[model samples]
Target: MTSPYAQQGFRVGFDWGPAGAAAVPGSIVAVVDVLSFTTAVTVAVDLGIDVYPYRWRDETAVAYAEQLDAVLAVGRSQEGITLSPASIRQAQGVRRLVLPSPNGSTISQQLSDSGSTVLAVSLRNTSAAADWVAARLTADPSLTVVAIAAGERWTDGSLRPAVEDLWGAGAFVAGLADRGVGPLSPEARAAAAAYREVAGELPEVLHECAGGRELAAYGFAGDVVVAAEVDISGLVPVLQGSRLSESSKPSRFCPVT
Candidate 1:
């Protein structure tokens, strides 16, 4: 029997974190973490860098980066090329980077073994990611897609359901709907509706949201601005094996209006 939690009847689904990802398995899975992870990925991919998602920023991450000949991103306060999108944007001479996060990156690494074609989605690249998924769906009628919002963790180490990720996932969901790729699950529809409600005021809302405010307090306000540049990116970062690189498929979809 198909698990009801899998949202089996829908062509598109939405859920939160690693558990949600496990519940709603799809041929294509998009992991969204708007405050940082996915946003940083978009920026890095935009600069022609390959991003390898890691679960922790410890010595293990250093060894993994060495194994792949990549630079390991440090904490925001510690040095060069942190997880902040602005840091990735300003970085140069980096062909590959290992970025670790407890939320998005961890979930991404967990899903790497699920046999799903994983894509990194953020406000900056929703259109491109959606278009890529939609094109694949058109080619394969059996294909299903799931958008996972990698919400932050609470102090006690529980999901905090970050609003920024909701919007980011919703933006990708809405993009798929706009491209006529629907029959969406209720969770997916709700996310799309939420995105539509705040489409016009994304920058302001992101700046004011808890995650955004926290980053701003840490002096990373510019990262929030970069993350809020909805539809500005044309590159789709697709996971191949353990690293995410630009999709080789040529995009034929219309730009977001």
Candidate 2:
């Protein structure tokens, strides 16, 4: 019980738009913009959320909070977004609170600031990334791992808004933490397997997306596809405030290769 088993660590799920899904203090924060920011952050947000297709993100925290139907308290920045008492009603359905993010900026930013160890995840590196995080728990047991999907836009479980980053991220979570791999819940296991089943070229899938296409116009087409793979980075970038930098990198809890 002195190890990961004894710790108060818990697993939770949420959608990461610009305002990333929030993590508990001192938890591990994983960000996946299988479509954009994972690529966009790697490249740079200076491109302004797509120069042409131009992303849509709110200006401030107060305005974003007002958009929700319930008293859903949202936290965000240009980096990522997070929600409290994780629930789907806040995500979709009639009068759904539109997630304010160009890609996963706000959420990305939160993961950076939350003091939680952060890893950029996707369908590409599901095994490797989660292994990287789980190994860390042996030493730091108070792990609060939050898988914030670079979610897609859905209406009545069909279509409305569009994006693919969430798909890739979801698959990674399922592959690594769910399905009995890492003490995950059955619900999480089901979700993970679902994503893994369709896991493929994440970036290409989202290339035609609003933000992805916009990025292409801004001369960042290749970046999207590149960020889709796992273990591609020699450095698993960390989020600090609104910036993705190598300085916050975790101390090799698992092999990057």
lDDT of each: 0.92, 0.45
For model 1, residues 1-257, the per-residue Cα lDDT tens digits are: 88889988899999999999999999999999998999999999999888889999989888888777789999999879999988887898998899999999999999988999999999999998988999999999999999999999999998999999999999999999999997999999999999999999979999999999999999999999999898899998988778888998333222111
* Candidate 2 lDDT tens digits, 102-150: 4454455455545666555544455656666656655565554666665
Once fitted onto the true fold, the runs of candidate 1 whose alpha carbons sit more than 4 angstroms away are 249-257
Q: How close is candidate 1 to the true structure, as a TM-score?
A: 0.95
Error of 1 at 201 (Å): 0.9
Candidates in order, TM-scores: namely 0.95, 0.52
Query: Which model scores highest in TM-score?
Result: 1
71: Cα error in model 2, Å: 37
